[model samples]
Target chain A: MATTTVSPPAPGAAVPGRRRRTPLARREARWAWLFLAPWIVGFLAFQAGPMIASAWLSLTEYDVINPPEYTGLDNYRELMADPQVARSLGNTVYYTALHVPLVMLISLGLALLLKRVGRLQGFFRTVFYLPVMTPAVAVGILFLLLLNTQDGLINRGLALVGIDGPSWTTDPDWVMPGIVLMSLWSLGSTVIIYLAALQNVPRDLYEAASIDGAGAWARFRHVTLPMISGALFFTLVVNTIASLQMFTEVYTMYFGNRQTQTSFNSDAATFYVIHLFQEAFQFLHMGYASAMAWLLFLIIMGITLVQVKLSKRFVYYEGEDQ
Target chain B: MLFVAALVGAAVIFMLPFVWLISASLRPREYVFAPGFLPVPFAPENYAEAWRAVPLVTWLLNSLVVGVAAAAAVTLSSAWVAFGFAYFRFPGRNLLFGLVLATMMLPFAVTMIPTYLIWSELRLTDTQVPLWAGNLFGSAFYIFLLRQFLLSLPREYFEAARMDGASYPQLFWKLAFPLIRPALLVAFVFEFKASWTDLLKPLIYLRDEHLYTLPRGLKVVLDRFGYGGEQQWEVVLAGSVISTVPMIILFFLAQRHFIEGIATGGRKG
Candidate 1:
């Protein structure tokens, strides 16, 4: 876990002189740019250029086939009026709300359990992570089978305990929950993160807490939680962002060319990105879609900023100045 | 004792979908949803049927090529950029690196359509190039990962190589590259898995059925064979298993690297 075996000076450690550079230093700088040329080129082409184009396109109505016409914020106005936009955004927020906390809790619980395992840690970790490695499309299809109303394994399992399972795929009320269940299968990475953080917590702290006559719960609350809060916060933000963009799994299960299966409550799973995809690709409303994308980008940025601000109060980073 | 029992129970629950998938894949059409874990009336013909029903092999091959191209492109390029960040002391370097990391926070939704337009403008849409070509520049996350590894290496090696009159490329190719093979492999396998599982890019860029990757092909398979068309649950499960086995195998082989990479990522955060 201690990866930096021989730590060198930090990447941007201050050089001796501030005003001037040696010839050798200048030569090294030239070589650095040369080394970074590919990424620079890519940043311009794929990221920066596309971002500017997306912003400009958001203000203009230009389908791929049509000449550009300035829309003057009409797309944004329509977005505010569009019921599907609101519905999709609501669905995304709902999914994120349920998915993020559940994932963090389950993953943290699994990590705690793994920390207790003695010899078979690797074996259990592999089993837990196997589902994470499965392709989302495959997960979607597998879950569709598992969550079948009548004969799915999930319902069959529930029957054993005399609890009738809801029709997960077909019922509108249960569709998002089904997606959340599918999402839980891939919490293995989060679990591993928490485990790493848990292992990194100094053992002496727990011992000291016990010696101070603290119980297990107090020891965990006072010693464990604060020590691992950094990792917990990291997963919280990452999982929230990912959950907000839920797409491939939902699309594969409910919407993608499955005309026959469209009778189900597919609208319940129409996430924001899915709606944006339909607007851009399906309906050729590229301008409107770009507006939607910018909206999502703002929402994500705002949420992330809020999370980072909140983390300052909660997350404990060792060796940092208060 | 209770903890271990609970862990085993949770693991079983976590593994239930996979177990049911394999079992359903092996069952006859009539028993596709049988309650028991075992495939009582075993039937392996579902694999054969799934293969015949769609171009599963072609999709698998396309995925392999795309995955390899993407992995190689991103791994090399990100490593090169990371080496620059790690080894050099240049003005504006920190600002540039910060810019690279900022790109990670930009959701793909914002850039998806515009990037598609860029590809289409280049007249490269509907080909496999759009899928892997973007990786030629490199990814921010991989660049960050490899940079951490590069930063940890002893600088004396590079300085000594420089003193011996080795050119920067020679130093990187002959020394830095070999030293950071572990991190590079981690980057490669991670990108490969990403490309293999990627459905959106293929769905957006590729229109031809013959050019489909596994995930994209599986989507179509779901439509034509699964709940959408024939309701052939066994056949669909067989396809799911086929698409998943390679990744499972990859995980088992590179299990250590995968876990280590994730752990390092957490620490970095």
Candidate 2:
């Protein structure tokens, strides 16, 4: 890595030797702004603006047809008071806790398997990733069909093995397990990341480990893990954020019926975003949803900050290793 | 030999959906109950009947329009932003780039409802605009991906363009675009795949039967067929197979980039 010297700016001094903005530079800036205008407008109009609105809305008692009444902390207070909200939050954390680690593990395992397979590397990779290309709606439907109570293939297969299968979707206990299973099948994206990390690991480290008579597990622990810790951190952070915001599977499979508005059964799967959707769209509590959104933002930020802070303990950077 | 068997086993398991979809599609309506590997007395009309049952062709076209529009929009916008970040030094450039990265953390959940409201207020809902426009800002992920690729290119090429009085647009369009075709194609395939298989936004926004995408269209078929209990079992499976086949073909066609993007690289933040 290269480092540059840092210069201190003079205190309370207007620097006379600042780089002048040239005509070409100005022209480029204008073009840059023009090129970036859509994104700027979109961020302002959709993301940032709504987030601001949602924050404000979270404090008010607002329905769709009526103007929001200022009811400071009422929504938050209600959120604290609501058992269903608590259940939804608990369910979300449970789902994330169960899903993210499982996903990371399987994806890494699959990637390692592919790494071991030398000849048909490209072919096997493509086969595993085919599911990633399939849409969530299709995935949900496919799983729904697979998990059907009586005639579903999964149940039938279980029967063939002389074991009866539980009702997968309808039963609350099995429903989450079914969701976890579906998630495991779609670990293609993470597997790709692991493969990339694996490729980046220097061959010399493994060679050195072998020379030292280290077993495969020991080599992996000391060599592979450290080398790819950067990628692992990146993947872990991203997977955390994405898993926390999961919605499409439940929305497609459970709540596609528009009639059952704000019910907790589907909302039982309300991993954070679904709750925000429910508040903002279903109940027209835009302000409350906004607060929830901000809370979500803060929670994610806090968690990520803590992760980055604590990353030094486990994350082995090459420069640091030297 | 063991390795080959393991790979084969995994492939077969992964390929189960495609096999089940096709087999179920070909079975006679009454033969749905039969306990057999093959669909007894194959009903070829299942395909035709599924086609008639829903606006399958129209839905496919709608999906194409949305997919192409989104793919193009994301590709162009990402390239532009990526070029700026990769090549230029300006005030707040690093901060702006950091801001873009930070946006990646902002959950779609936070934005989904407000986006719908804004579109509804603008009366852009139910049109293809919402579908394509959802991607118009260019994704943080793609921008980052493109920027990574762009950084690896020789800087002197752009400097040479500048020395020759090549305008930014000219440099971007003529120089950058062609050189980064591989990265651009990767982004295109990604955006295309996401939009093509997307069901939620379309389901929420598009109510018109003619405007539905394939996933949404397939749902209509499933609902009409209404799970395994009803008689239209073969037709349901046939429609699913029909919906899945194009993607299967596209997967085979772009298998190189798709595999590269998913199996080994392009996903790290």
Q: Name the top lDDT candidate.
A: 1
Docking class of 2: acceptable
lDDT of 1 by residue, B164-194 (tens): 8998999889999999999999999899999
Q: List residue ranges in candidate 1 displaced over 4 A.
A: A1-23
Candidate 2 residues B112-205, lDDT tens each?
A: 6667777888998878799888677777878877787777777777777777888888988999899989888888987888888877677668
lDDT of 1 by residue, A70-165 (tens): 988999999999999999999999999999999999988999999999899999999899998999999999998889889988888899999999
Each candidate's fnat? 0.86, 0.39
TM-scores (chain A) of the candidates: 0.93, 0.85
| Model 1: lDDT to the true structure | 0.90
- Clash count in backbone of candidate 2: 5
Candidate 1: the clashing residue pairs are none
Locate the minimum summed-lDDT window of 10 residues in model 2 chain B.
B260-269
Steric overlap count per candidate: 0, 5
